[model samples]
Target chain A: MINPQGLMIVLSGPSGVGKGTVRKAIFDHPDTEFEYSISMTTRNMREGEVDGVDYFFKSKKEFEQLIADDKFIEYAQYVDNYYGTPVDYCIETINDGRDIFLEIEVEGAKQVREKFPNALFIFLAPPTLGHLEDRLIGRGTESDDIIKNRIETAKKELEMMSLYDYVVINDEVDAARQTIQSIVTAEHHNRKRIEQQLRKHLLEVD
Target chain B: MINPQGLMIVLSGPSGVGKGTVRKAIFDHPDTEFEYSISMTTRNMREGEVDGVDYFFKSKKEFEQLIADDKFIEYAQYVDNYYGTPVDYCIETINDGRDIFLEIEVEGAKQVREKFPNALFIFLAPPTLGHLEDRLIGRGTESDDIIKNRIETAKKELEMMSLYDYVVINDEVDAARQTIQSIVTAEHHNRKRIEQQLRKHLLEVD
Candidate 1:
């Protein structure tokens, strides 16, 4: 068990598992003090995407510089997009008494897990495989071939669920969100800290 | 992580660290399905102790009778009192989808750990050795001799904390409770189940 004040939460899942949606719900939860991490990427941002918010879009040189300095906690080159979590930003946020939440893919999640052993890793899953396919098909941007690829990729992702700390099924959005909230709330109460606080209180009480 | 629902939870702490208080708070939490095992004792019950609640309050004959019948889950003689948790009750409760909570001494906890590898063993503690003495003395129930012995015993208990799957420090009641709740909740999102569920969902969808 650990503290309630600050945590590095990694939420990972497949392409169509509604991970982003669940994260949104957690972010909007009342009195929640968690902050979303900004991924540093070499990819160009589309219109309306702000730097340091949507993502800290970086030039190839800057991304390489950060990597050289070990400023990026975990970075990967995927299909020309140099994407990684900024290390210092998350550490700073946690030190400020606020948790940093990361929404990353399975590979990225594994990398974060290695670095942050105690960080909470939550695996979000689609309610049903059919639902996952429906979501993919419903997206007008993708062709049938692309949708098929995504579904296949999701299957591979499923194989890795056992690697995470928690596997949360997104069958019911509200229930899943509640599960996330409660889990986050509970992590703060782990054994060592609780003992410290209680011992302190017991001694101070009288 | 694996329903963690049907798992056994072994709770152990030094005497006067208020393991009972923490256990009580855990049982009182809503949506928590747990059966706090009632220990059977060969010793006579003290005043205000309820049968089948605080303990089974068995006579030596009854206790031996149960032992002969193989009714106890894990039993041992401690400080002249023959104490044991009814194995039948724990099995029944766990099979019923409720987690079993056993508040036992460190020795008994080890037995539970050995018997049930999936069982979650949590050690409760105070922040430091100095604080432990304060809590024990604050209770005002033990003689000076007894208090000293307890302090010595508490050190042994602290040493065993590292063996436990998790440790909880009873620094403050509510905060400790929150941490435990989170660990349990987060654990419930077992990676195996998600993988299994995802694979099953994928098959259906395909």
Candidate 2:
């Protein structure tokens, strides 16, 4: 029998695997609803990006303050930029009956798993390593060295592919999006969720 | 991490609850593949149903013979009709990597759960008892006595809702289809699946 409970989908991928793009497509999905995880990052706000919406941009000092206070569920420093996922907000939303979505890097995703063992971890993979490299460069914002560094990071990420639950190849946007949709929809229909639906059903019948 | 090995989704409900219709929708789905569970029955075939396809319609003697030989995994008698899920077929399909879908009645679903505890059981519910009544009447094949028995059977079936894993209210055709789809997808993206996916992924990378 199916159990009915809300599921936590922890989505992670390397820098240029179009995780952001996939999220955008999912946000516009007609039948689904979600609460996005806003990360507290030490990285400088990029052009046109807003704090609290695009990212909760923090200074090195402010980020450290939160870390010392133990406010984040998982935190990491990438190229001197501190990033962390806030725990309370994500948990609250899920408790309120909405599935929480965490878009994080591999390390952070691992941390979340350690903490929330039931959370679903999905890894977004590019069609090929070559495609990932091209996507990083085609973005045009990063310098050659940064692009190269990201590629190396991607290799390490791919090595940790086993750490993810699902490897979604982002070859075709529509296909990949559908994959994500299928996966997420599948999660909501978890055993606990189904049991809940059944309980409601029995009550209605009785 | 998401598990790579797929899941077994047991779609169980009462007769005329549109389990077949829901299964048909899922079968026709383009993005995903599923395996249908073939059943063994002793009920004489009604017109238009095929053997080995609609059911492995067997005689009482043949079914009892198989049972005595211990060839059947699980079997039950309902309204003087003997029905069962053949062990060999389920094993073959499950090993083939597709989720096994069994359109079973409540008792049969419960029995299957005993044998395969990890199977995802999704309860297909008609919108209302009235709707169920209408559906049974719309069949136009059964006698009044059989129709009354089915309606009573449906009521008893609803009482078994708590025994199921998930309950999907199948009201409208398209909406119910989507709900079932979502439920199935969600189950595949569960924590255990994540663990399985991550393990397989590790093997692939290694």
Candidate 3:
């Protein structure tokens, strides 16, 4: 049996689009072959956050060095803290024949797209912009003005939906998860990938 | 809400690859939104064959007229009989927002590709050439010589796999069906289609 290269899945959307809930739902499925890609971050570890599981914690200097070395697929600085997807980890995971998932934002996704255009980019869209606004307001963590700002940011982020390979509506968590799972499964059977496998099979016989 | 255009799925493979079985399994799934396209044929229908369900039986002259009128997306002459895919029916079904599955052979698929490049072309591959040979033999209706010729034809057909969008191996009937169903579901969320839907939502001022 020829071992096919695993799919690289990037799940992203505007904040409060329920991406996290949808990701969790997909991860919870027992039959899905998935590995979550741990990103490197310069932000201090929050309470109960594990260094590697939640994120690969690094100092500002260390993160900058990685940047200098071109070790990241995409990186961004937020409030003087750096966050990025490590190129090495993604390459290793995909080469290991296991599908890897990256939960990222639009800007990070754009950067990743430049590096790996073949990756399956899925946008987890809220049912509507109004629904997205309601979810942001429902969180109760931000002031009304902040919520307003978040909504405005979301509109801009939503424009990135056209850049993705699939747009899964997060009307219901399970449905969105199922749709993502289907995308991954179907992508594995993509003809270009299968052609490489078949070519190998052809060579062995001749 | 913008009604997204439905997908046209072209299922093709070598003879005796169990395309019918796989297609049935997918259609049996309650949630799969599929409408089978009824092809028109000049060949005489056998006993108990319904006019529309089995095929749109047509006279040789009528079929030729349709060909001249460009009513068929693809048409082929086999043993003095004609078989074709009608363009109008497919267009109407897809415009109605329902996915249409076209079980066509390589030549017909190529014609469809010329007409609609975006149609999802899927090749149903056998586990191996030997497996395909065994399948033809197991059918027990063909002579040894006929079986040998069929196997040779299958080999040539397999080479066309590279032209398809995806290739699903028919090692197990149910699994193959599930994969096809997934392809259909996943294609519904393709980025290009969702962009149109999203654009409508973007223009709607709240």
**Highest DockQ model number:** 3
Query: Candidate 2: lDDT of B186?
Result: 56
Query: In model 1, where do residues sit more than 4 Å from their true spots?
Result: A1-7, A41-51, A57-71, A76-82, A94-98, A114-119, A139-141, A181-206, B1-5, B43-47, B192-198, B201-203
After superposing candidate 3, which stretches have Cα over 4 Å from the reference?
A42-52, A56-71, A79-81, A199-206, B41-71, B78-81, B202-206
Ten residues in sequence with the least summed lDDT for candidate 3 chain A: A197-206
Which whole-number lDDT from 0 to 100 does residue A100 have in model 1? 89
Ranking by TM-score: 3, 1, 2
DockQ for model 3 equals: 0.51
Tens-place lDDT per residue, model 3, A51-146, is 887789999999999999999888887435787888877888889888889987788999989888889899988877888888988877667887
Judged by whole-model lDDT over C-alpha atoms, candidate 2 comes out at: 0.75
Please give fnat for model 1. 0.52
Error of 1 at A21 (Å): 1.8
Give the winner by TM-score: 3
- Please give, for residues B1-206, the per-residue lDDT of candidate 1 as tens digits: 23424767787878777776787788788955667898888776656768888788888888899989988768887656788888888998888877778887777777777788777777777766677788878777667888888777776667676567576677897766766666666667656434564456555764
lDDT score at residue A147, model 2, on the 0-100 scale: 90
lDDT of 1: 0.75
Cα error of candidate 2 at position B171, Å: 2.3
Model 1 lDDT, residue A65, Cα: 90
* lDDT agreement of model 3 with the native: 0.82
lDDT, residue A189, candidate 3: 85
